[model samples]
Target: MTLLPGVRSATVDTDRLRMHLLAAGPEDGEPLVLLHGNLSTGRFYEHLMPTLGERYRVLAPDMRGFGDTEPKALDATRGLGDWADDTAALLHALGIERAPHLVGWSTGGAAVAAYAKDHPVASLTFLDPVSPYGYGGVRADGTPVTPDVAGSGGGSANPEVVARLAAKDASDESPFSIRNVMRALYWSPTYRLPPEREDVLVAEVLKTLVGDDGYPGDHAPSPHWPGVAPGTRGILNALSPKYCRWADVVDLDPKPPVLWTHGSADLVVADASPLDFGVLGASGAVPGWPGEEAFPAQPMVAQIREVLDAYAAAGGRVTVEMFEGSGHGPHVDAAHRWTEVLLAFLVSA
Candidate 1:
């Protein structure tokens, strides 16, 4: 399909899996890869892509079993690290070995971090929870350990939403919990949503619950990592349990200027103070999202403070910005503030 700013995409085979990546902008332009959240595909960015495409070479590829891509063999072992491998393969196939800017959201944040640590990404722009929620970098062979998402609540807690979602199994389709949580988002829903946009995100609910073909594009999934290759199920089995713990992964080295923004209202993964993440320097107060259950649950606020403080003290180039009246994905949910910061980061960084 036609993407923002005349950018387009098609499926290519890197190895076994079919990969779909945005094919927009000049081939030689500086590259920027957009990674989506878990259980989400690149399709979500259909509306947001154009904003970035106006200036940079943008590519948003769907991960395995998500979005437009077809499901893999599913021995079922894939986890976060494999995603990094997928990025590596994508870059290799595209002949891009040098570092490029990566704007990763949610789990995509973790995947990109893994890529940056090993490869040369120009920088990382993180939105909301930085990554792996602590339960990262677990060795595939290590014993499986459930991540301490005990803090999945982030730094804020919306008790009403919690009780509502907890009450019913919406049906196996939407995964009772995920659907209910998302329910608050829609009054109407989305289908042939627009720049059109969906109201209340009804269509997304139907698909997630109904298992419809979300990505109706002509392309296939990326093969860079493996199309449920020999080791996918193994990867999933070893890593799924540890995904939300906030301790397993840390940014040992960050390349590309990092711009991070979280909602003052986010309870899922409240961010450290602006001074900590470098968003505002020592001039601002450390914002808190008491409603979120993620960070506070695992001492995330303090941990983030420690990291931000250490990074700043160490002269790390990071920025932590905030938004009010919003939650985790301020970019998608509260586009104005997010877009301003994002555009600034893209141009300035």
Candidate 2:
């Protein structure tokens, strides 16, 4: 991968795992930890880090199962705790005594939330994070569609897509190919990554470990319409509501200021996310939706707003910014504006 000038790569052995990271800026600069989402690595932030490095010590680590981090099975039952704790351990190991500004993208947003709850942080910034409740198969109130939380987690991952990822199929011939998936889903459909940058991002995704303990993880059959439930292990299951739930973050002691930035066009974590099985089935995109009551489209954005509103009501500081034209990865699709807003938030915080 072609790294920006001043960016360096290293592996730090924390108590929990060996975290491979891309770091920039002065070692003594105020720390800003950038956490990437699922199917991505620290390299995902390579371009964003350099500018931020001018003012902050930027460290972006590939969480346990992705990139150069040692492959380790995530204990899905603990939800995002594994990732949070790993992040804490890495900070401590690196001798970062003060709480760093935490920035998380997508699933990484869930990780930072879990981290902020159990640990102290200067501030929290979520870039199109998953809902405070979890992903799909749940109501606006966070109740599961089925008792087992069917139609969510690892089982919800498309088998064909997972297979392509496993095979490291870089071809864009099919929608399932990693390249096409990134091109079609990772950013705004109207905006495309430059060829070289796309190559690097795709390579970073291919580094993910693919198995029951890896990317999509494991699942079990369910009686629900979608007919699948979270298995007991792996990254995808770790995101399942059965394991991941952080609505109580509003109650976190020493509540930090939260800056939530999202794209109005984000399809991955929207009220009617296209990636959500319930939405797909309901829209006739997938057969046998079983209608709204049995399996309603997950109101992911609403769930996040509800929790954030509660946080505000509870006397915590929160700000929301919606980028109109960007998709899931606004930092990429709307880089200049995203950077300006993000920098202003960091500086003011």
The most accurate candidate by lDDT is 2
* Candidate 1 segments exceeding 4 Å error: 1-5, 73-79, 130-180, 183-196, 199-255, 270-296
lDDT of 2 by residue, 271-339 (tens): 998889887997898888898888888898888899999998998889899999788899899998998
Best by TM-score: 2
Off by over 4 Å in 2: none
The local distance difference test score of each candidate is 0.49, 0.90
Worst 10 residues of 2 by lDDT: 180-189
The C-alpha TM-scores of every prediction are 0.64, 0.98
Alpha-carbon RMSD of each model: 11.4, 1.0
lDDT of 1 at 34: 83
Error of 2 at 272 (Å): 0.7
